[model samples]
Target: QDNAVPKQASGCVSCHSADGNPLVEGVPILSGQRSDYLEAALKAYREGRRTGGPADVMRFYTKELSDEDIKEISEWFAQN
Candidate 1:
């Protein structure tokens, strides 16, 4: 891991753009979304509140994130 990169930052850009737009179809666009909503959604995936299908990928990605990581990510996307 690079010392300068924020945790969880690299993982998102592949599917979700740096500006929070989803690169693929069927993926939600996170740009302009509420921070609280983003955080809650991430938390839901992390906590297994979402199930099956596309949610599986989210769960896998968010599982390693701490609460603060989620907050930072949510804020980043929300501002885009």
Candidate 2:
């Protein structure tokens, strides 16, 4: 398996931390999350279907993510 960090994770770790703990207050931990759930959430954000706190931020980030990008990112965080 390729264990190197995913390129897409750079922006995520700024707030969500590489270890899964969020560095910022109100940011949810991404580590140990379910990959399927994460993928769905990311897709929702990309589609502008998810709303609430940080929704705009998430939408911005996720908008350019392809399905494979979402899968890789979600799996990376889930396994961490």
Candidate 3:
């Protein structure tokens, strides 16, 4: 791993951000969503109770996120 990348680089937004992966379709348009809801959904996905589609990719992603990170991403989407 490179020293320049932060430890939090495991986050989806770390690579799939607007400037990086804005082209991927059906990847939730996080912008303008409610923070609390987003946070709860992420938690659900992490716990395997909210499988998405047939593959449940969100579950894998959410599993890697900490509570603070989930809240931060949710809040970022909610505000911007």
Among these predictions, the greatest TM-score belongs to: 2
Task: Between candidates 2 and 3, name the one with more favorable lDDT.
Answer: 2
Q: For candidate 2, lDDT tens digit of each residue in 1-80? A: 33767999788988898885699999899888999999999999999998877998999999989999999999999998
- Report the lDDT tens digits of candidate 1 across residue range 1-80: 11233557678767876654678778888767899999999999999999999899989999999999999888877776
Ranking by TM-score: 2, 1, 3
lDDT of 3 by residue, 3-65 (tens): 232334345554345322344566666556688998888888888987647228777667778
Error of 3 at 79 (Å): 1.4
For each candidate in turn, the TM-score is 0.85, 0.91, 0.66
- Which candidate do you rate higher for lDDT, 1 or 3? 1
Assess candidate 3 and give its TM-score to the true structure: 0.66
Give the least accurate 10-residue stretch of model 3, judged by summed lDDT. Answer: 1-10
- Runs of candidate 1 exceeding 4 Å displacement: 1-6
Candidate 2 — number of clashing residue pairs? 0
